[model samples]
Target: MSFIRGKKVGGVIYYSEVENVRVNGKVVQKHIRYIGRDKDNPDHIPIEKVHFGYIATRLMQGDLSPSELFGMIEKIGSHVNRENLERIGLFYDFKKNSFSLSLYRKRLSGNQKDAEDVKKG
Candidate 1:
């Protein structure tokens, strides 16, 4: 399973995706992806306000289905449109009433190399 976790470095809190994987007989939390910095911090990086990591984590864990996730988004009144969703690797198909994850587009603005590494793995 995957979840969002925050780690503090140099007085700033950065968030990332962590997944529990069993290696050789022990379970360990592996770093899946870097999400973003805490916006509440003074040195926070100016990224989009959308909680992409949280949403993606929930979706990947089957905590919520795609349509249900969108419903929650609509309730929150976030300005997350198709383009923003695509940027985070979520593709919604209206005709099929489903969505897909595009690993290529999932990484944030500057994590191209990490995304490639995830693909290779």
Candidate 2:
């Protein structure tokens, strides 16, 4: 599995995807992809550099702070609301102020194919 790794060089923090592999009878960490540095806003990483899966994971795990979460959702333009989040297999509990992956992800109710299939033999 590949995960994000961070390093500081010349006063800039660089992020990259790294993975472990065996070579020469020894296991070593290898850099998979160079994700870039956030020069201006340290808190804001380029959205293109990060995968959607990571964002979803953070949101579900409550790893992101309120401002960070809202900023990320706005930057991603993912339309994260109760209805949309639920539609995409995520749960947002307003009362508890929590986000998580839904156990009972509901399927789209008005699919044309499903309707047609039901009418056929």
Candidate 3:
């Protein structure tokens, strides 16, 4: 299962997604995705807002379970209201207690590309 991990470097904390995988008959942690820096720091570089599509994609790929995804969302301080979910081609199924992508994926206007730049720096 994937979960958020924080590593400190040069007195700054950087967070990312990581999971355990079997490698050469040994279980090891593999880096999944770079999330962002500690938001509480003054020098923190803000990354793009987490969208419903990202969560849905990860969920569908089995990278994150429902509870893990929700925990990550809560840790990141993201808002997951119904209107916001529909805006990004996602919806929460109350019956199934899970999130699913909609037929039409609506792209939002924002600094979606900024996260890549931040990761590079």
Best by TM-score: 3
Model 2 lDDT tens row, 3-118: 87789999868877789999999999997545445322122223332444676778689786655755665676533333212222344446655444322223455685487468
Q: On residues 1-121, what C-alpha lDDT tens digit does candidate 1 reach at each position?
A: 8887889999868787789999999999997545455322111111222555567668688787756755665565532333223323554556545443332223355576577569879
Candidate 1 regions off by >4 Å? 39-121
Going through the candidates in the order shown, the clash numbers are: 0, 0, 0
What lDDT is reached at residue 110 by model 2?
62
Better of 1 and 3 by TM-score: 3
Candidates 1 and 3 compared by lDDT, better number: 1
What is the lDDT for 119 in model 3? 66
Record all residue pairs in model 1 with backbone atoms less than 3 Å apart, i.e. clashing: none
Q: 92, model 2: CA deviation in Å?
A: 40
**TM-score of model 1 vs. true structure:** 0.33
> Using lDDT as the measure, what is the rank order of every candidate, best first?
1, 2, 3
The per-prediction CA RMSD against the true structure, in angstroms, equals 14.7, 16.2, 13.6
Q: Residue 23 deviation, candidate 1, in Å?
A: 0.5
